[model samples]
Target: MITILMGSIAIGLSLGVLGSGGSILTVPVLAYGLGQTEKQAIASALLIVGLISSVSSFSGIRQRLVHWPLVWLFGLPGMVGTYLGAWFASFTTGIVQMTVFATVMLAAAWRMFKPSKAAPETRSEPSNWLTGFQGLLVGVLTGFVGVGGGFLIVPALVLLSGLAMRTAVATSLVIIVMNSFIGFLKYQQVLTESQTQLNWHIIMVMTAIGIAGSLTGQRLSGRLPQQKIKSAFSIFLILMAGFILYQSLPALFPAFTL
Candidate 1:
């Protein structure tokens, strides 16, 4: 219980502080800390993260950091994609799932490490068509792996839309929440079939505590040197990715193990 609480706070703090990278930690914490099966952990984590990110994005909204145009532009189609991805995930094996998770994290890490800084975004209304297309692509990725699409959204906002990092992060949070909901619905089918019951009390308590911690971290985001922090985080994620890949490979290729 204590470990779960601690892990939740840690994840929330990371989300609040880093914005996009926090979702990557959800699976490991749920699986390792709460002693959940891979499927249950991933599904439950998606539910929790969706809620948590929604709240966090609200804070960004409070701070006037959210970009509404981008949110719709990216989140609309993403919702559909998320459903498709979740359905696909149901057919995947644990080894394959972990491998895919690790690969995605690694790619996120690489993106964070070498972020492209160029023009700042101007606050303006966006076209409906653009939001729909981006949302579809992001949603598919999110639904497929039970991951927040912030990893992809952040870059797209920064590069294509010319938004600031904070704005990109804020927008990513909103998009992630919507996409997560889509994934959560698909995941529920499996959970119901398996008769899984998450520790809701624990989940609730952890989420409450995490919200406080995340808010504090969010306040610090503007003050901190994000690049340095992102680089350090990227290194940590890379190490974790390497370890996960190493462990899962043996199972995927049993012949190589012998």
Candidate 2:
């Protein structure tokens, strides 16, 4: 229980400070720290992350920093994709799932470390078709990894939709919230049995502590060195990938000894 609370604090702090590293932490925390199977870890992380993100998003809402229309444009398609992705995940082997998820984390880390040079500026509402298409892709990716699509959504909002970084973060929260709720519905049956494996006491404990951590961390965002924080956060992400690879890779290649 204590460990789960700590993990939640860790996740919330990451999200509050960096905006996108929470999911990377979430997958590992649930899988290793909480002793959940890979699928359960991914699914549970989706729920917890969504809820936490919504809480953290409150500041953005207060400041009117969110691009509300864009969120709906992206979130709807993402929900569809999430369902498909979760369906596929249900059939994959544990090793395959972890490897795929780890690969995604590495990709997200790389993107965070070396973001696109293009900066967003104010713009009129985007064309419906373009936004819908982007949402579809983001949603599919979200479903596959059990993430909220912020890693992709932030960049997309900035580059494609001309949203500022702050706005992107705020809008990404909506996507996370909506997709997670819908995606979880897809995994409802699986989660019922998983309830036995899940440490709910830990979930509640973690959420309470994490909310405090997140609130504090977000307050520090503008005051801190963002690039330095992002760099450090990337390191944590890479470490998570390494951990996932270490635990799941060997099982896939049983003949190998390492």
Candidate 3:
């Protein structure tokens, strides 16, 4: 419980300060720290991250950072993709899910490590079809792995939709919130059918702590060195991803060894 509480603080801080990494921390916190099954961890992550992102997005709205045209173009498809992905996840096992999740963590780490070549200005407006396709892919990732997919979304927004970094961050929050809620609904249905119960006490406690941490992180964002933070955190992500794979792969393949 203490471990999950502490981890939740990290999750909120990452989201608040970086506008990313909430799902990365939330999934592991619930799964490893709290010793939950993959399904439970993912379900709880959707709820926690969705709510935290909803709260964090208000500031983005106040700052007018969101691009509604892009939001509609990208996020609507994302929602549909999320529902489809969650449906697929329901049929998979813990090992398969965690293995895929580890792959995503590595992808996130790679994104963080790469310095931005993206400009703050609009290069071009990608076609609506291309934008929706990107969103669909990201939404599928979110639903299947229980991520907010901000790491994926921000880059896609910048590259495909020509949104600036700050705008992408703000816009990704809205998309994340939408996809997460829908995914959570699916997971909740699964839990009901299986007669499984969530640890609401943990969810409530983590949400409270995460919200507080998020506020503090907002205050610290501009004050902190974002590049340095991301660089160090990327290394941590690599290590964690490797760990997750190491633990899960051998179980999935008896013949495979580290």
The number of clashing residue pairs in each candidate reads 10, 1, 0
Q: Report the alpha-carbon TM-score of model 3 versus the true structure.
A: 0.96
* RMSD, every candidate, angstroms: 2.7, 2.4, 1.3
Q: Positional deviation of 190 in candidate 2, in angstroms? A: 2.5
- Looking at model 3, residue 127 earns an lDDT score of 78
| C-alpha lDDT score of every prediction, in listed order | 0.78, 0.77, 0.89
- The all-Cα superposition gives candidate 3 an RMSD in Å to the true structure of 1.3
What candidate 2 gets wrong by more than 4 Å, as runs, is 115-127, 193-197
> TM-score for every candidate vs. truth?
0.89, 0.90, 0.96
Better of 1 and 3 by lDDT: 3
Q: Which sections of candidate 3 miss by over 4 Å?
A: 120-122
- Of models 1 and 3, which has the larger TM-score? 3
Clashing pairs in 1: 73-131, 74-135, 77-135, 77-136, 78-135, 78-136, 78-139, 81-140, 82-139, 85-144
lDDT (10s digit) by residue, model 2, range 76-143:
88888888887777677657878878898888888778844456355576788888888887777666
Ranking according to TM-score, highest score first: 3, 2, 1
Q: Which runs in model 1 stand beyond 4 Å of their true positions?
A: 120-131
Q: Write out the backbone clash pairs for model 2.
A: 78-139
